[model samples]
Target: MPAPATPEAPAGWDFSDVVGSDSSLRRFLHGLPGVDQVGAEARAAQLGTRSIKTTAKAFALDLAIRMVDLTTLEGQDTPGKVRALAAKAMRPDPSDPTCPPAAAVCVYPDMVADVKQVLGDSGVKVASVATAFPSGRAALDVKLADTRDAVAAGADEIDMVIDRGAFLSGRYLQVFEEIVAVREACTAADGREAHLKVIFETGELQTLDNVRRASWLAMMAGGHFIKTSTGKVQPAATLPVTLVMLEAVRDFREATGQMVGVKPAGGIRSSKDAIKYLVMVNEVAGADWLDPDWFRFGASTLLNDLLMQRTKMTTGRYSGPDYFTLD
Candidate 1:
């Protein structure tokens, strides 16, 4: 190796400010889901803002994405209502040709077989939630049993939420240990098998520093994907939170060379918003990982808007969200 060159500033490069300072750390901090400041108007402003409409190209990148568990969606999902929503979410209709091919159908573990049979030879995988979703407050034995049952039922992917209450209340070790055991459980029951996405419910965490730490903790604990929000929380999946996670992914990649995935579930209501997320990935994580395998948007309400946008792009006249049916 050549002798180390003296640390000299390259022309206009300013190292004095960042070479060794808290400001560097702050700059990293600033990048995490800076969403509190970006309200709906700001998000609206980002519309017509360079969208990657779901097209053959968008679907063709090396990776694949499945919109998991849209039926058990938050905001309006209730007991009697869930089954119908789950049924409709899995149903395929003739009118909506613009809908992208979901890599899998995500459902409550009970609905896995229903979706599996309905999707039939279409090759979409089946995913199920485990470890007591929405709130991961179950007894460890119960949670493990839940995981075992879902896998035994043939779920190809497992989307699990971490205990946010425990994580935020300074029980980091508890969360870490839980994820490790759950991951191990997945392996034992399903082979080194089902993909594990550890949902952080990032909206509930008070700060991005916490988000970064949680991201690291989840990945370190063997989570295949680190996700944002349960969509049940008040502030699920905003651009800023996602930005923070992407930066975390970047740093994690640099540090450990592990290519982790990201999922931004909830509140993604339109193709424009989805594109903004794609923009964040391009700008932050680079074009190399732009495929859906590395990123996903989880929302029942979003697919319609993405279809409407796709329709308008080809025909040049927009159809309102209402006119564009979700079937």
Candidate 2:
């Protein structure tokens, strides 16, 4: 089959025209090229087998380490726990200062201040999950308040979940407006708005086509990054789902000249699995997206594995799992 047509936004594509009404947004979203489920899965599986050489493997491992968003989003999260996580984010390996810090440390809004205290000037960002994260079922006002609170607490990035009920039920405009509002609520300190990461919880989306549409929808609404899952759902961040999302961001930039990021969260545990994602990003989204800013792995346990691999590669001996803190 011929490659899918690019939903390249028409030159000078105006956001207002598309979001002017439910009908307009629906028409544009539904008209986008349909996803080929079989093709996407086959491509993801094929790319997963590509091998990396020893030298490149070392670099890719470190790059993957840097791309990780070390996260601890639990109901029992305390200031002490948040502080420890922050420490780990800043220094994945206490023994080696060469180990680059993770891209950010993600936590609940209430823990942002505690994390900030530990990560001060250390370069590890404080990312908070807001807008009724993991479950975007609350009212719009409640969600906006949640977002504002996180930003006020110095969150560099806000991860908001979309109202899947609205999207699946054909309330695309409502979902669009919610994202727009949450993005607005992401106030920044230095005149730069906090980056907004829109989470689709792909497993809940049910199909590759939905993933593509949701990815486009989030980007169009000003999401700095489009994320796969909240890690609370089953089958989160599968390679096929991530492949579809990467394609959306690639095509979006082609049309709008705007670069959006992609994050595949949850279920990615080992260094081997993380490297597969790196290969996919390089192959599917191009080399420009290989950086931590353009892509991320929202994970808790992934960092530890990357540390272990790095240790083995440098010391020529596998430092058993106990060598690193249990993230």
Give me the overall lDDT of model 2: 0.91
Per-prediction CA RMSD (Å): 8.6, 1.3
The 0-to-1 C-alpha lDDT of every candidate, in the order given, reads 0.64, 0.91
Q: lDDT by residue for model 1 over 280-303, one digit each (tens)?
A: 677666775575566766776766
Over the full model, what C-alpha lDDT does candidate 1 score relative to the true structure? 0.64
- lDDT by residue (199-256, candidate 2, tens digit) is 9999899888889889889988999999999999999999999998898998888888
Sequence-dependent TM-score of model 1: 0.74
Give lDDT: candidate 2, residue 283: 88
Largest TM-score belongs to which candidate? 2
Question: In candidate 1, how many Å is residue 287 off?
Answer: 1.9
Per-model TM-score, in order, reads: 0.74, 0.97
